[model samples]
Target: MWDSRTPGIPDELFERTEEVPITKEDVRALVISKLRLREGQSAIDVGCGSGSITVELCLQTRGEVHAIDFDQNAIELTKKNLKKFGVSAHVVQGKAQDVLPELPQVDAVVVGGTWGDAGKVIELAVGRLKKGGRIVIDTILIETMYHALAKVSELQLADIDVTQVTIAKARKVTTGTMMLARNPVLLISATKP
Candidate 1:
């Protein structure tokens, strides 16, 4: 059902206006740089919003992708986005903590947005990964970042790293003056032993 031009999606996905929407370009680059996805490797995107990354996962790797989200509207949007890109992925509508138990082990996991249960979800995600598997998570809140760091430590993951991404754009303050607008993101990544 999922092909290069087919977008596998539903109609009831979630909608978020406050956050910057992830684009295909973002997904493609991230998958290549961060995940280094290989052919036949499996991946899961927890809290996948609009399937931007999920669809990219499908495209970059020949492996199957499991895309999950709690919001029905976001799930639907993910479905639409996947179909629009002609990629195929399994889109699940449910909480990550609840669905992790049902999925088979995977090679990589990406947590795009945690809905308040980051620690528990990360534990489960790490547990379900194959040995040497990778986990990448993103957070805007320092509290969440700390919690994830602790969890990775508890899990004994190696090569732990946290990076801050700042994007600044120039906005016109006047005809000759401009101001810089900044957006920041925290990315944490680790590898299971």
Candidate 2:
């Protein structure tokens, strides 16, 4: 079950009724804050589910936003969300590894999902990034974080950082009693040299 308090979804999103495995508001905020996006810079959002981060990227930056997802349902949801949010972003439906090579190089790339091909995705994304461009990836597992770290080392990114975010909320356990619930996330960001 998904937490109702989690923001970014709208009533029209439920019309399609396809489950989104994970939605991290912290990741969204971190990507926006860390990227320090500038006007007229190009950006791409890989595995862009429901276009939440994609739309946000377009809104926050003056550059063009390209959002891609392989799942048909996710693509539709992303399109719906983009329209609902009134953001202009290019939506593409395809695998990240395959579609990435076709698009023009960009200033920043955000990996929302990699389908377990983190190494290949990162490599392609880094290759496409302009000199000194940034790459931001969100991983929920230790294994994925290790993979990202390895890729950063392999690419020899200039500066690298891995951050873990934990959000705790108060949960009602019983009458007049409450407990703390926590959700943890891993964020890995690097810049191409």
TM-scores, in order shown? 0.82, 0.85
Instruction: Note the clash tally of each candidate.
Output: 15, 0
Error of 1 at 68 (Å): 0.6
- Cα lDDT tens digits, model 1, 59-147, are 66768899988888778887877777666788889988888899989999988767887789999999889998888887778888988
- For model 2, the stretches where C-alpha displacement exceeds 4 angstroms are 1-18, 171-182
Off by over 4 Å in 1: 1-32, 170-182
Best by lDDT: 2
RMSD of model 2, in Å?
Answer: 4.6
Worst 10 residues of 2 by lDDT: 1-10
